[model samples]
Target: MAVPGAFVSSILLLLASAAVAEIQFSEIRSDDRPIIPLDDFGFTHRGWLELNVSGIALSKAGLELGNLGFFLCTRDSWLNVLKELEEEDITCALQSSHVKHVFTFEKLGQRTSFDVEFDQEDANQYTLIFANCLQQQLRVSMDVRSAMYNLDGKSGRRDYLSAGKTILPRVYYLFSLIYFVLAGLWVYVLYKKRLTVFKIHFFMLAVLIMKGLNLLCEAEDKSYIKRTGSAHGWDVLFYIFSFLKGITLFTLIVLIGTGWSFLKPYLQDKEKKVLMIVIPLQVVANIAQVVVDETGPYGQDWVTWKQVFLLVDVVCCCAVLFPIVWSIKNLREAARTDGKAAVNLMKLTLFRQYYIVVICYIYFTRVVVYALETITSYKYLWTSVVAAELATLAFYAFTGYKFRPEAHNPYFAIDDEEEEAAAEALKLEDEFEL
Candidate 1:
């Protein structure tokens, strides 16, 4: 039994009429992500949405064809478009809110439909804009069932996300636990030694505590966000701790590189004033960064402020290097003139090398991680950051254990004149320490 020619002709005429009456769309390939949406863990965001639109149709439900215009929208900017469209006699639902970029198809294309793709940021909602160009009363039916991505595993990429989902939280949490243990042990050591003043022991303890808290924030950022599928407030703490870590790094290098006694007797006031300025500036900068993250695309002012404060922090960190390097050189030269101080000179030289290594390792790993995670989208490099921090901490712990403090000791090997000056200055100083 063959179908009649008249029936086939009638069906073709109906399709042609439908195309003229309303717009139609077909979805195409967008991102190569797996079925599960990847949680960005406070960095390195990536995803996309693509769609193909069939030709528009002109039908008389209640208004003229010339009054209608179709639009595309994404989650964040959809509300703006919707409010504007409503003022223009268009009513759109919030459900139709997923367009980051817009594409217009020529009304006279040879193909019946065209495709449009929107790169996903932190948004996921989509919408279509319908308008009455002539302000005439009209109603239209749109076929939008196939407009979004087909999440039935037919169009998305193969599973690269599942492994990340499972492994990332476990690894981050493991490191966090280790940091917590290290922080606890350091606290115990501080308590036992009765070193509660703003001395080197207390300062290092503070650094260790901040590092532990930072690791915990990272772990929570991964686990809770990945599990609940929403961001938490720990992100702010993460940024704050990160900047503090850099500040402490600067302080640690200066303190260890130039021995506390020399700084205490000669330059305590200058160092304290500079540090007071630097620490507050870093805190404010880090706070701005957090505000920018919270405010998203609308935080340009805060972003600029953050960049400015970051420059301030950088300058402060760099300035500390002068005092550190100068002190190291002076001490090394003084040791050379007196052969009796050779053993201490060797130890001092070794300490200098170790401190330099720690600083270099930290900055190098930070740059690598930032490039890989934020710029290149290689999220696995987060593990490298964790490993580097752990190794740095281990080095610090070993050094501190080996170099216990002794009273009236001359581990720094300064010249006799400098020693006499330091002795005289210490004798004249008040009991209050810097």
Candidate 2:
């Protein structure tokens, strides 16, 4: 929810610096996402905008106005507020403003804490605007540290979370719970076939555990922020787990694509090269995620970091496909050359299916979910999370089912009769060569 890279910007409410953070406007910034977007992310981050004003250096005109020179309004009404401020007869601002908080400049010290509030009637997203309306050479300058806190009222929740993503905490937890169940099931399967289970099976389980932990941490991060404007150490756990999950996930994908631990005990030189490239790319991607989360679009290098994250993500995705392609090609050639064409054909089909599934998983998470987020309403943002998680779960299950260990597992196991036939064929070939 309100974890790193949760929202598109730094408008999230930070409660405690022990783990989570808040949006701090060190200067009166430009119009690059200056209108802070407020949402509950499913009330996982349900909190209010608590603005701490500092360096209250204002002009004579600002002193005359006697207000903090900020405006909070619903997103729809915000544009109207701006349009109204453009006209000379702007007395309507005090009356027409959707957010009624008036911060008087009188007795305003170097640091003043102003808690912002709004009514529950309006069913829409709220935005915080920092501006000096008079527009005469831009007079007011202040350092604002805005923290989000949960309003512990039913009416307040209805008002603050009008965009309706309050279901995200539950959504993540629900999926986390599902993964927990799936993990249990996987363990059972591994135990039942413990004699047949390979090292890759255990690796798959670790990936599942990491993914579960990541989602659980994310849910807690949002929930903690919602309740107290801080995630304590939950945010830290989230970031750590998130990084682990990312790295492990890509590694697993690359390993599985190359059929490592199944068909081969060690990576080939070229396969090792692929891991060398993919792992570092994942690191870059995770670091970019953190930077994007902590710094807003207002930050100077925001665009560059966004580009870095996107580029690295796409490259990593493309990189993982290479091993799968090689595996498929190798299998196709083996099916033609191997005397046991029946067995080789089975392996070939499995690899082709693996390639298709990997492509689909990448497409759904990277491409489909992105389009869903852009096209859907703010209220349905949780759907993107759900869709991505579901696709991942399906992929995981399919991989487990198709590759689970067994004596007669067509993928890796050959019948005794086929083995005998293959031996005879090899004997004949050797005799002919001699």
Candidate 3:
């Protein structure tokens, strides 16, 4: 009875082993047969299969099936998956089979899932429907988490290149180049003429050159972004350039204000002193702004400050116009009293200068308008800015040439006849006094 019982137990054990083996083989066959249904986020898919599994034998196929599925899935969603994976420095091995596409995802808690689907569209084209499903799942998860964590402080946050990376830097670079070149030419002319105005002109030129350099740096940064597919290193350079640009703009305002005061005889002493103080204060404020901007709530978006200062500049320019208008009026009155052709001619020249100032005022008004529009995120306004700036530069250059003493007299030497006549006039005046 004991022998019979032992033999029966051995037979049962053999039968159990065979059953297990058959089950394992069935699972392997199921994994090898690749027709996956994919559904996610308003999208559904059918017909995707795995290829190149000939090396994966039936015995060990179950253990390798999950990994193979993941590899295939990742291959299907390669573009989107690559972006996230590269950010985390994760890499996966992949081989594409013409039969089907694979989708894979690594989830929380070290869990991974993947699916394979066959291609119905084209034999060569295998779509990764599983990747789309995974992407939708991630999106939904993120949305739910975002809703839970939604707070006022975290609202409206954005990245650096949100304003469209390529265009702004390019526009700035081109405009800055043009501005610097024009300013440099103006400075050169002032220097050659031995004009006392050279000091202010040089300062303005330096400011424009610095602005140009900043734009060049920005362009280089954007180029780096295009090359590397990243904008990680732009912030430091951006902040440095921002601070410098503010300082330069402040200096420009001061230099122009002071030069205008020197050229205009009618400005009150108090006004002149106030302008001097304002210029330095603005410079200091701009320096402080750099620090404040870095730590402040507004952060790098403080480009709006450019518009603010430009508005102030427009106001100051308008104030300048008041004095110019008054001077022109006074000149006209004086011309009526003097009635001399030379005096009238001088008044006409001065009138021409006033007209030039008017043109500049219009140009600046347009600039302010465009600047405000830009601050408000109107990109097309820059075209107006460029046009107005070019016009202003052209008019300024023309006026500078027109008013130049050398333009009227190339040699700039007093004529012998005029010197003799002046000597005779002086002799006559002395005789009359005697």
Candidate 4:
């Protein structure tokens, strides 16, 4: 009798282990996606989501829900309901949101499955939240698959791309073409003025080329993701180009502001210090930008990465301005106390114009465009992006035009006639003294 009892106990223990093995309550992301943000929000015909669940045993996990297994709601609604769920239960929160997708699991300890197709609505961020009305007690594991497809043929946007970002691919392509054209024109100018070209001229050319490639890669990356929800390796290329473009652009801006190659052949100690600070900040900003772009709201630490990106970007913007201020002061003092006041006046005016342009670019891109995005209707969301690109293009054109290599350029170098006149006057005075 004792031997038989031991054998029965071993069998019972095996059965219990097998039963609990199905309960996977950990944060393993292989199957269940608890939170999904609907970036592709629209009004009339948003899209469709096909949801499937398998191997779900919510009740066995010690959840005593009357009927609800899971549900979906707008992000705002989700945030609002959390406090209620903590104070009361999931049912209390459910009563407030009638406009939600609710799924029910009724069986107990059975491997049950249910699939649903929902027509998504609302022009707000939607989220998918799994229901544990009584709060999950056991670690339950389940398989869930969700696929979103578009039904609006007129919008011409894939379901994966958010409505506000629908036109980004086109915008990137257009700007990439523009940058390529400008780069070709710059090459022509450089070849024509090869005798007067400085190292800075080539650096500008490189920046233009990098900008074009960066935009091209970005266009491809967004286009692919919009179509298939995957970058197909374009994202890697985009990241590389984006990193190179960011570093080069800031470096170019700082170098030009200090007149490193044109006004002077080498950087001053302070100028070098500015470069050191700005470059590292740019690197941090770009890395944070990459993290923000790659991670959705559902991803861990997404908001933190976005905040880091914004902070570092603002710091880099402020740091770049210091060199420009130094340049303006030097030009102002030269105009006031030097013999070539008129020449310095021309350079001073150029620097001031550039300063204003930089400030306008930063302000419009950072503040005004964000405000536009927040307030603009969903239909007109792409306009903010267009405005930003337009501002960037204008800034680029103005900087290139003002700083182009040329023989005895008035703003960049002393006028040849002015130099000749000063030399002749000095020679005449020396002859009179002899």
- lDDT for each candidate structure: 0.45, 0.63, 0.38, 0.65
Q: In candidate 3, how many Å is residue 375 off?
A: 12
Strongest candidate by lDDT: 4
Residue-level lDDT tens digits of model 2 in 326-380? 8877865675567665576567668778888988999999889887865566556
Off by over 4 Å in 1: 1-167, 187-198, 236-246, 261-269, 301-313, 336-340, 374-381, 387-395, 398-434
List TM-scores for all candidates, in order.
Answer: 0.51, 0.73, 0.40, 0.76
Off by over 4 Å in 2: 1-49, 57-69, 72-121, 131-141, 147-162, 411-434
Model 3 lDDT vs. the true structure?
0.38
Better of 1 and 3 by lDDT: 1
Residues 244-332 of candidate 3: C-alpha lDDT, one tens digit per residue: 76455544443333334234534467445555655555555545444433322112222344335445545544444443444455554
How much is the lDDT of residue 58 in candidate 4?
42
Clashes of each: 24, 7, 8, 4
- In terms of lDDT, the poorest run of 10 residues in model 1 is 31-40
* Model 1 agreement with the true structure over 161-193: per-residue lDDT tens digits: 222232455665776677678777767765665
Over 4 Å off, model 3 = 1-165, 183-204, 207-211, 217-271, 277-281, 284-314, 333-434
Candidate 4 structure quality by residue, lDDT tens digits, 234-353: 989988988889889889989988988878899999999999998888888888977655543334455567668878888888888888889888876665566675566567667778
**True-structure RMSD, every candidate:** 16.6, 8.2, 23.9, 12.9
Of 1 and 4, which scores higher on lDDT?
4
The candidate scoring highest on TM-score is: 4
Find the number of clashing residue pairs for candidate 1: 24
Q: Rank the candidates by TM-score, best first.
A: 4, 2, 1, 3
